[model samples]
Target: MTAQTTDTVLYRGEDYDLIGLIAAEPITPQDFGMTPAMISTACYRGYFCTYAIEDDRLFLVEMTLRERDGRYLPIGGIQPVADAREATCSYKDLRIPVDYTGSLRLASGFVRECYIHMGYQKASAFETVLDFSLDAGRIVRVHDRSAEAARKRGAFKKHFEENVAWGIQESFDLDMDIW
Candidate 1:
């Protein structure tokens, strides 16, 4: 859709459903850590899923909940964003970590993982895995290769990325606190 179009799916989320949530903000070039010309916005919906567009690309962060007075509070802004320290994979040169407790799962039973930070020297990375079927080509042999931190990190990233993504998409309990 054109940026000027009023009807759009990629909205900044400032409607009635997003009243209490934080509105999308500009992610300046400095926010991306490379160029000073790139720009994006951090948008929220019903206190969930903060995302932005940087140079026409969609970027998201991992969301986590912290216990506060018997309640779980979201840590990475209104929607979830990725944390660099949580998990990572070795396949990529930069080794982007998985967002939101490591990994997220999809309704199709596919696992999705994210890594790297927006502020990193390079673009972030993502992976999709198929765990339910042996025929799926996404499966990797990590049990023995995960001796290094990178291998272990990649495996964990895939595992949880699938779970969280699935939970969010299905509205069920792979991850409850964030979705």
Candidate 2:
């Protein structure tokens, strides 16, 4: 098990100072009622977020949406959205908006997930596939997967079957945005 750290974050309609840990566990869509995709593509997809709930309440992460390619893309992690009370505000990484309904309040505790490893783009030919992760919130890892591709490059048919880990995978600070 990884070590746990205490941090604060703005989430949903509340700001919480709480304990967090590395999310080494993977989140799968079958974990939810949905299919294999979270953010789906006519061609690709995104990852899943798993969280721990407190007192039967969980920090719900929402994003600002704009339409693209006939689909809604989460442009920012913040902005106007719903909670126990309706409001639009930037909590943690969420984007702030112009007009929204609701009130922002600081809570006694908060928990949020960060993308420690993300945006692994596969190349078509000889380009290196960069798999990145922020180590200790200081160092960044760009893994060259061209060799891995050379060995196992094939047609990607399934959405959730893609090889990638999304969301916080290890101990990280929340409020300071420390990884």
Candidate 3:
């Protein structure tokens, strides 16, 4: 299995990979009346979204779609390009306010030793983990769970090293599984 591509989020002036589900009403290519072509096994979802948190509110900053010709097109938060060849030209960045009123998990500083070959890496594999609670796109609370995640990651690493005989560690769940 290929490692899946992750969505990104800009929070507190830093970029973090979004973990697990995105929002209560997750945006998709179909949302824009478009069908995306598979770019690669890693991006089977055919599209990826870039989100940002500004003024305590969440916004969908960008959306890139994979075309059948293997060309990635920025369909959202971009100015219309008269010429297809000028698509690479600079354009204004726009933000679409998202109506997500739920929890979001952001992670960064991935530990290479805890790398997984398939799917998204577990939250525990990251050196930093942040849990955010939002109300209608506005961040109501933030939890810095990095320390707790680090502890879990350390335990997983030790177990993986001791049980090297188990071969590749496909996935690690922080809340479930004994090790």
Candidate 4:
């Protein structure tokens, strides 16, 4: 099928089936990190996933969820995003601790996103493991060896990125009282 053909998929808590649009522009490594290899590997390994929302602000999720049987369920939950800017900044302060292990680090280190509802509760947070080499303060490469492993696990599917973006969008569309 051609890229123009839209794909339909089912979602929860809502009757209308959802559709996904493959980004007109495939995410290049430069979009996420300093080098293509890093972005490619990161995208290949579920590291650098980006999605646009209706607002000018950017929302990133570290995990993906689904609505099943009228309840929210986490189909994939890895790192947690903060619920508020304070929480997100606090997370930054704690980045070293989180990145102490290379497991979550990608090429240029991860640009983690934490979703907060202001006075309400925390939505969700996702971290794109950033582990890029730097030379004299310049970005070198994104060296995540999980490419093979991600392929073995089929992490390159386009649905993953779509779902992540949709989840964050849904969170934003909902009323603060509902959450």
The models' CA-based lDDT, in order, is 0.22, 0.27, 0.65, 0.22
Model 1, range 81-147, lDDT digits (tens) per residue? 3334532111111111212112212111112243311111100111211111111112122121112
- In model 4, how large is the Cα lDDT of residue 119? 17
- Candidate 2 TM-score versus the reference: 0.23
Q: Give residue 27's lDDT in candidate 2 (0 to 100).
A: 27
Q: Give the winner by lDDT.
A: 3
Return the top candidate by TM-score.
3
Q: How many backbone clashes are present in model 3?
A: 0
Question: Which residue runs does candidate 4 get wrong by more than 4 Å?
Answer: 1-19, 38-46, 50-179
| Reference-based TM-score of each model | 0.16, 0.23, 0.73, 0.17
Residues 1-179 of candidate 4: C-alpha lDDT, one tens digit per residue: 01111111111211110111111222222332222121121122212232211121212222211111222222122233433422110011110101111111221111133223221111122121122333322334444333332233322223224575543444323121111
Ranking of predictions according to lDDT: 3, 2, 4, 1
- Candidate 2 has its poorest 10 consecutive residues by lDDT at 98-107
What would the per-residue lDDT of candidate 3 be over residues 3-33, giving only the tens digit for each residue?
A: 6777789988899987754444345656655
Give per-residue lDDT, candidate 4, residue 25: 23
**Each model's Cα RMSD:** 19.3, 17.4, 5.2, 20.4
| Model 2 C-alpha lDDT per residue in residues 70-134, reported as the tens digit of each score | 23223332333323232121123422221211211112311112211222211211223323233
Order the candidates by TM-score, highest first.
3, 2, 4, 1
